[model samples]
Target chain A: MQFLRTVLTIARKDLVIEARSRELAYTTLFFAISVVLVFSFSFVVEGVALTDAAAGILWVAIAFAGTLALGRTFERERQADTLKALLLSPVERPAIYLGKLVGLLLLMTVVEALIVPVVGLLFQAPLGRAPWLLTGLLAAGTLGFAAVGTLFAAMLIRAHSRDVLLPVVLYPITVPLVIAGVRGTASIFAAEPNLAMAQAWLSMLVFFDAVFLTLALWVFGPVMSE
Target chain B: MVSVDDVSRNYGRRRALARVTLQAARGEVLGLFGPNGAGKSTLISVLSTLLRPSSGRVRYGTHTADGAGDALRGHIGVLGHDLFLYGDLSARENLAFFGRLYGLDDLDARVTDALRLARLSDRADDRAGSFSRGLRQRLALERALLHQPRLVLLDEPFTGLDDDSALVLIERLRSLRERGTIVVMATHDFDTAEAVVDRAICVDRGRAWPVAAGAGTLRERYRRTLKERG
Candidate 1:
């Protein structure tokens, strides 16, 4: 119950703020649209190239937009020095991580929803068999990215070149998720649509999400407090 | 009661607070007097369970401050120079938000009471980002009081307040003390310390001087010691 309250409060505050500003949603959607538009114009969408390249382009959009959202998750709090207040509360650190994860998931899902239709219309690519499989993978991938990004973003905010440093630090560690996400998308988009192959990527996503989230929670309190 | 024994902290080669010891009973408001870099913030951070000491220990009731000091933190409230209130949230929303974190019952009622004490009930719906320095300080105080904590560690709580706000805060501190809450405030201001805190300790070069009974107030003693030490 304590953990749930912590998650809810943090997530609620973040979502409320995002709702008011609409920056997270707006930026994420714009970025996703630009990614699809740029790819659509750059590649010939009339032939097999459109179908063959859809999964890679889709994962790239998710990864890139996910990074943008997670990067700003704690910027306002850190800037206004409110993170100290949050830390001072009795809620454990892991709860803070989970709360941020949920907020990021919500925003990332919104961006994904926008991108799915855009991808479908622009690329003439179908979501294919196991559509929910695609959503599940996207959710897991977003969770992994958000967990690692939130932790690193907190650290980056303390450094000299935070904006430049955030992506440099984040993108490298999150490569596994990007790879798994693409492979997961590819499995669903493939002709055979093999369950075992899709499950493997999904399993990696889940495992990565669990591992990074636990570690991020363990390290977040000390880093943010400092 | 809270006790600190030989607590010290270091960052690489720079030692912040070195082997400082302090003790305060319930209801006693202790003022820590120090200039910049006197390790006042570091000491407060360690006691408030925000930072771990490189050496020594702190005790709150039966709990040790090293590993499980978090249990002690639950019973304490901290208001640092950093307002620590979310700027986007309204004054009441900020209070309500923190009140829930501390699991306060009737969170809205608690927020209402806090805003009243902070004299911000009229501006409860105003974003904290729009507040003046004095108003922000007042709101931060309200945030600290939302949980009705038994212990409070304040770092420079009087920095940005006007005379009226200062007086209001002193009155609030006195009431908290009357209710048996231990308040530890670190400040560079003697007049404010003289008005609010009962016992005062001078922190210099990372060591806390032994508090002694003297004529005048704790602030007077603190100024005299700084001069004498110099």
Candidate 2:
């Protein structure tokens, strides 16, 4: 019960800060929109081609924008040495990781909400056919991304070139999630959406999230410890 | 009581703290005076469990840092060089947030007391980003004390304070000592050290030894040590 309270406190703090500033949400949304627009113009050889490429473009945009959000999210903690302060508290380290993961997931979900419709409009992708499945796939893939991303962001918080290093360290480890996300999303955008294939990819994403989240929780204490 | 035993910390080839040992009992204000790069902050970090020593151990009463773990941390309150309050949050929000983290039972009342203690009640609703350096330092100190910790560590607490603000802080330190809170403060300012500290230790080249007299004597000793090391 205390653990859950601590997690909620941390998540609430981040959300409150984000709600007031809206810095990460606004910037990430704008960046995702820009990425989608650029891809639509560059990749659309014809209407059919645009629809086919939509999944890749949408996921890639989320990946790029999600990375930015993760960096900025940790950057707030880094600015006033707030992360160190958080570390000094008696709360469990994994709780901190979980809280950050939830915050990142929420921010990424908002960006995805905005991006999916924009992608649908611009590329003529079939987003309405399988709304629930699409949401599930996005959630699963983003959970994996945030699980690993939060860990690396905390690890590199004090590194000299953290901004440059975050993406470099993050992308390689999360490639499997991205692959699963793109495949799952592609299936959803198909003329007759392959629910089974998307489900398989979704299952893979869930597995990845569970395994990586456990690993992150296990390693957070030692990595964050001085 | 808090005890540091033969603690040594190193970063690569550079040694930050040598096998330094010290002890502080309740109702005492122990001042750590050192020149820059003399490992005062590093030693304080170890005491606060923010840094693990490369060798040696820290004990709070009978329990070691590892053994005590979260319980030990719960009794420690630290105000370091960085103001740990989030700039975007209002002063009241920052204190309330940390009070909840410390699991304080009466969070609203505790936060109110903390705000009054820091003299930040008037500006409690304003964003911390708008606070002056001195106000921020005061707020940080308040945050450290909100949990009613038994052991308080302040690293260069007087760095940015004006004379008036410094006096207000000194009074609070004196009150903490009177209440039997073990206070360890790291600073180079002899005047401030002489004002509040019950005993002083001068550290140089990663080692520490007690100063024989008050701030004036300690100042001379520190210069002599620096000259000898050069």
For this target, which candidate reaches the highest lDDT against the unseen true structure?
Answer: 2
Residue-pair clashes, model 2: 0
Give the lowest summed-lDDT range of ten residues in model 1 chain B: B65-74
RMSD of candidates 1 onward, in order: 2.3, 1.5
| The candidate that achieves the highest TM-score relative to the unseen native structure | 2
TM-score of chain B of each: 0.94, 0.95
Q: Give the per-residue lDDT digits (tens) of candidate 1, residues B1-230.
A: 99999999998999998899989899999989888898998999988888888999888877775556455567888998888977778998888888878887887777888889999889999998899988999989878877888889998999889998899899999999999999999988887778777788888889888555668666667778887875
Kindly list the interface RMSD, in angstroms, of each predicted candidate in the order they appear. 1.6, 0.6
True contacts kept of each: 0.69, 0.87
